[model samples]
Target: MLTLLTGLAFGLSLIVAIGAQNTFVIQQGVRGEHVGAVVAVCIASDVLLIGVGVAGAGALVAAAPGLLTVLRLAGAAFLLGYGALALRRAWRPGALRADPSGAAVPLASVVATAAALTWLNPHVYLDTVVLLGSVAAAHGADRWWFGAGAALGSVVWFTVLGRGARLLRPVFARPGAWRVLDGLVALVMVVLAVQLVVRPVGGA
Candidate 1:
């Protein structure tokens, strides 16, 4: 029971950080487009990563520096592209409407984007598979329970983020608010991308 609670708290602490995945979820939630799908994908992905980590995938990934390099570069490229799009949107603030009535972003696109953001981001790998797995290892026999707790944390966090974003709809209803939000999102993506390139994952 103690192991479970520890895992839950640890997982929440790691994921609560502002990251690409959370940003996308918030954007989708605010737009009121397929919030449930985005949340589900994030939760499922976290669960899978946590399981893989607990199963010892972290050691294998650590041994393979080349794989990390490839993922790092690819993730950087993807982030830069996404950031460019956000920057463009911010530049043309008129294009952003808080209203869900605007033509919905296709369900398939949203899902794909969510998956890419979650999977391709090296930070997610480092946090869930590497960091969480290492911490879970300390619990020995109770590791699976710890993993379950972490999975539960993911489910709770994403669900709240996706649902709670609607509460900010009134603020987003104004084009200026959207401009600020997208501008921040773009800045975050670009900064993360630069960090990935400048400091490779697992580097000193």
Candidate 2:
């Protein structure tokens, strides 16, 4: 029971961070787009990564410096691309809308974008792979319970963040609020993208 609670605490602490992935999830929720698919992908990806980490995939990944390098570069490119889009929207007057605008994008595109946001980010690897793995392994024989608890936290967080985002519809109905949110998201993505390119893992 202690192990499970510990895992839940750790997982919630990490997931609550305002990262690119969470930002995207909130945006989808606000737009009333394919929120279900995004939430599912985020939860499933977290579970898979945390499970693999508990299974010792983290150690294997640490051994392969090359793999981290490739992921770092790819993630940086994706972040930069997304950041540029956000930046354009942020600076372009009349871009922010109080309501959903334009036709809904294809579900395939939404899933692909969500997957890229999940898989490509090295921070996800760092969190689930290195951090969560180390935390769960500390439980020794009870590591699986810890992992399950952590996975539950992830499920709960994404569900709330995605589904509960609609609650913010009233606040986000203001165009200025959206501009602020997008501006913040763009800044975070661009800064993180720059950092990844400049100081990649293993100093690659």
Candidate 3:
């Protein structure tokens, strides 16, 4: 029970953050495109990474000094670039139009994007594999329980985020509402990127 609780807390801390991938997921959900597929990919990716952390790979990565630095730089770059894009979108007025004639975004593309965003994210590895993994490792034989708890958290969060967005369809239909949401997303991205850059060295 203790291990499960600990894992749940750790998982929530990581997932609650606003990142490029999450912003994209919410946008896609609002756009009425392949939402189920996108949510599935997000959940599955979290499961895999969380499992890796619980399996002790996180400790291994953390022990390597320069590796995390490289990942941090990469993550920072990605966040900043994406943040700039979001800010641009926020400044530019645009219609949220779903093309009735266009085919849905490909499943393969969705899977690949999810995988890249989840796996390539240095923050993900640090949070799940390193921080959460280290916590679970302290559980000795109860590590499996910790992993399960963390996975449960992922399932809960993603399900809520994906479905809840759908439930907000009425609000999203308002042009002004989407503009506000997009602006909020843009602000979140910029703030997160700045936080990442100014974060104390080795803070993650």
TM-scores of the models, in the order given: 0.96, 0.91, 0.81
Best lDDT among the predictions, by candidate number: 1
lDDT on C-alpha atoms for all candidate structures: 0.89, 0.86, 0.73
Report lDDT (Cα) of residue 178, candidate 1.
87
Query: Which lDDT tens digits does candidate 1 get at residues 119-138?
Result: 88887888899889998998
Error of 2 at 108 (Å): 1.3
Residue-wise C-alpha lDDT for candidate 3, range 130-197, written one tens digit per residue: 87888889989999899998999988887778767777677766666766776777777667666656
Model 2 lDDT per residue over 28-72, tens place: 888788999999999999999999999878888778778788889
Worst 10 residues of 3 by lDDT: 95-104
Candidate numbers, best lDDT first, in rank order:
1, 2, 3
Candidate 3 residue spans exceeding 4 A from truth: 98-110
The reply for model 1, stretches above 4 Å from the true place, is 101-103
- Pairs with steric clashes in candidate 2: none
